[model samples]
Target chain A: MAADNDTISGYTAAFEGFEASLNGGARSPLHARRREAIAHLQEHGLPTARFEAWRHTNPAPLANGCFPPVVTAGKLSAEAIQPFVVSGIDGPLLVFADGQFVPGLSRVGDLPDGVQVHSLSAADSETAAIITANLAALALGAEHGFAALNTAFVRDGAVVTIHAGCTMDVPVQILHVSTGQAGLTTPRTLVVAAAGSRASVVETFASTTAGAGVLTSSVAEIVVGAGAVVEHARIHLHGADSLHAGTMHVTEEQDARFTAHTFCLAGRILREDVHTVLRGEHIESTLNGLSLPLGDDHVDNYTTIEHVAPDCSSHELYKGVVGGRAHNVFRGKIHVHQAAQRTDAYQSNQNLLMSDDAEINSKPQLEIYADDVKCSHGSTTGQLDPDALFYLQARGVGLQQARGVLTRAFAGELVDRLQHEGLRTHVERLVSARLDAVLADQGGAR
Target chain B: MLKITNLHATVDGTEILKGINLEVAPGEIHAIMGPNGSGKSTLAQVLAGHDAFTVTEGSVRYENEDLLDMAPEDRARKGVFLAFQYPVEIPGVNSAYFLRTGLNEVRKARGEEEIDAYDFLALIREKMALVEMDESFLKRSVNEGFSGGEKKRHEVLQMAVLEPRLAILDETDSGLDIDALRVVAHGVNQLHTPQNSAIVVTHYQRLLEYIVPDFVHVLMDGRIVRSGGKELALQLEDKGYDWIREETAAAAAATQPAGA
Candidate 1:
């Protein structure tokens, strides 16, 4: 663990300069909020490995670098974004370069009557007020440094508002590509699904070929209204050298259904946080995450589900495939409040350690204040079954390829659960290709 | 098709097979009857190249080629198959996929092009039906969640698909009931031909009734104490293994050299 002071010093200095420049421009209503958020980071600094939650994934590399914000946004054409787009979906596509939106590459066709989509800075005055009121509502500003920093610089991600009784047939895709040199980006997405409405959202984060290692700290806040259904998937496709810390916070109302899927496919250092609050009865909340880390990657996932009302249910399944010297951590907590009677929660964490040196630490905690609640949690960590491997090899599948098939099957369950067709196939191909690369690198096949 | 001479093997520093001799000609069904822990399964495993058993001193020849030199997979590719006493359940590997891969491996070793998915599906459906298995078995994980009988049937299904020249059945009828045993025996019988032979290792004579052996041998203390015609199994089943054990002991005592 690196010293927290040294970790945040570089960013703190750059942030001061950036703050001064923003002050010189026309003062905005968010100036105070941004200042307060940066002040919060200055007080707490970055979380070191000394912090229990940060024990497995050290945030030093992310905070130590002096990654100035994006300046002089690069040109993005349809050709450049074509490779990242999910084909067969004709819904809205929002493209962001380094935290700022690129109008030339974005396409928002005819939307339903009551749906509105806009970049944070470009949102109408009424939507701007809504965004401001909900900004950082899910994440407390003082607990995390990267989150506070993201809050301090939250300006140009996506703001989607679905009016009541509107159910979208197509999913909204948000693509954020970091290009040119190593820098820092803060992508803030706020989705508001009004009462009786439903929508699906997919957020993908990646880096361009010319782009060096970029450190990204992104925050997504989702609001699920009563009788609404919202499905969201966060895909991390950053380069092997990049660092990412993502946080998703959701709040569900009465009879609302919320499902969240997080894929940590690539990155040198990755950490994900998903927290959902169920405040109404008959609410169904599901959280799923699949992480495949190779080489010296460190991946961490932390999830929390708060049941504040009666008759709510939650389910969580998180799995990780760790290769080489990669290390993974999983911490899930299901807290049922006293008034949340008849709450049902199930949590399971499974890990596959492909290499001898790979490590996984999983901790599932449940705290129920109501005696009427039912909850269970279990975790398992081990290598691929030896008998299973021998069975395949005995039947003539090479040791290397056999490992590929079993590995695919281990993670394929999650891939098959993807409700979207194009996204499911895309992820399936990506995971297959990545498994091939990892197996090929093994050489001796153990 | 197969020959074993002066076979001495051990597992984990514990010797099991002291000395054994067996031979089988093409088109012959040889049954090796033995009591529990008589090294019946060890011989089958050693012949299949299982890493757990070490051949301390022995020679196994298949068509005049040393069988010990090949790996388990290489042995399979070279027309050798062993139906395990306990079929291992491999989760995440579909039964059809595993079967096709095995068949393709043998085909590839013979310099044949790999079969496509459609052909594999057709071939597996046909072979599975021969074993009395429904089509749903194709999608299941290899032996996972399958009954004991189903696993044995699955093994025979693989045999029908691979069509190995030397098939070793190691206690294949242990957990199977009468109907499953009959189905499995029938499937094995259907695949048997003049160019292929099977060595059936069993503790019960009931299995021998379905697939009558051309010859039966009683194995004791890891050695074949008596070699005879098919009536040997019936005699052992009727009179129990104690008579054979005492007879072998007396025969050994009479052959012992003076004091030294």
Candidate 2:
């Protein structure tokens, strides 16, 4: 217990170190919220195996090990980050290295009249007001240790604001590159889509090193106003040995629609928490996720969809391909409140186990308090269909290649949902390449 | 192009095919007719190198190569094709893409030039018309949500695209309507050449009217009881299979030793 306290204090000390460097914005409301967030972490400390959310994934690395905040941004050339960029996207490209904004490598020169893409640290007055008002509003600091640490440690992150009646022709790409620094980097992103607006945002987390033990605790908050449509994709392309914990909070208003696509492709230990709330009537929320974990990697996804109003609908589909001796966990909860009548919710979690030792733990829950609501949840974990495999092979495809093709099709189901051609193609390519590596590591021809 | 001698196979230790012998030559279509549970499907599966069946005692020669020793894909690459009775529905794999990959693999194995997507689309369009398949079927997942007749037609569509030397049709006419049957048979007949051969396995003689096999063999109790020209199929259709079963019993009784 004492060692745990010491590690918690280590983070507190890092917070203090960051607070001391703050000169002008220290007195701002966002900074004050940061102070309160650290105080909460100091009081509660980190969660353990006893915690419900932390039961499947062991947080000892973040609970016991001390990863001081990345004080300075790591220097990376434009060429180094080129591979992570999605080609053919005409929208602004916001780049971050080691959790700090890299303006030299970013392309923010865009005039979408009402669209704003800039760093949180360099936000304009109006943007700052929106950020301070809505940043921690959805994702509160008392949720967990990672959320608190993200609020306390983030100095620079991406802030996208879409005005009312506006539309973004191309998706805004936000790429966070880790320099493999042996520290904790907390990247914060806030997206506010005003009423009658529409846009797509793609956030990718990647590492520059093949095997670097860096911890990234990211927090993102999205506000979809009335009648707005927002599409968001979170992609993880971390190193083989990197660790990631991300939380995204989205609130949809009346008649608004929000779709979230999460692709966890790499990383040794990955945890993703997607919390969404339908705050008004006739709102729709869709959550889609795909995780391909190879080797001994561990990936856990916890999603919660809360229906706070009547006539709201939510759909969730999460798929995983577990290879090697990897482990995957998916726990989804769809809660319909008493006042929310006529609420419709559906959740499904499907996994394909590639190796004998690979394992998956899936739990889909529906807590419906309203009597007039309709809800259904199902979870299935299975191997590649032998009939499908033989059918492909009988067509002259090699055994190993047949397995690869089937596995790709399993993951490609979600990738095809991406409406953007360039992003969809890019994700397809990434998923294919990673799938090949995973199948190859399985020692082909099994 | 294909020869099987004294072939015996089993599924889960239960013998299905026992002492089967047959020979197929180029440009010839031999229809194997049998009642249910007579191992008609089992023989087709075994020839395609399906691992579920254990070939207890058999020697199958395809183009003078030991067909049993090769993997299912290897046999396919060596110009052997089996049109399954029940075509599998593979979701998320587009029909066009699946056909292209399969064709490329066959071409690569034959040391022929691989066809690009554009040319393959053109070739597939021509073949699709042979089976009356709509253009939308090409974009759908392979055989997924296809009607029973449509599945049969897709099998023939694959036969047209793959262009194998030896094609095995395992009950391809089952569950198909008259129009669909004619279309499927037309596709198979068009793909048939003097250099290629086909084995049309069916339980009914209705398909033989369209396919017009060079020879027809009646399979019963896992062995070829009788073999004759296409007229033999008509005889079975008229007299039913019980007559042949009775004849087989009579022949066995005559071969038995006198009272001992």
> Across residues B1-260, which tens digit of lDDT does each residue of candidate 2 receive?
88899999999999999999999988888999999989899999898888899999979998898999999999999899999998898889999989999999999999999999899989999999988999899899999899999999999999999999999999999999999999999999998899999999999999999999999999998999999999999999999999999999999999999995
Candidate 1, residues A1-446, lDDT tens digits: the string is: 24556546766777777777775542666666677777788788766656777766776677665567665566666777776788889999999988889888888899998888888878898787888777776547444777887877765789899989997768899998877447778888999999999899999887775345677889899999998999898888887888888888889999999989888887888888788999999999999889888787788898899999999999999998888777888999899999999999999999988877777989998999999988999999987877677666667666776788788888887787778898888778877877665554432223
Off by over 4 Å in 1: A1-32, A75-81, A139-141, A210-213, A440-446
Off by over 4 Å in 2: A139-143, A443-446
RMSD of each: 2.9, 1.7
Candidate 2 docking band:
high
Lowest-sum lDDT 10-residue window in model 2 chain A: A437-446
Judging by DockQ against the true structure, name the best candidate.
2
Share of real interface contacts recovered by each model? 0.52, 0.65
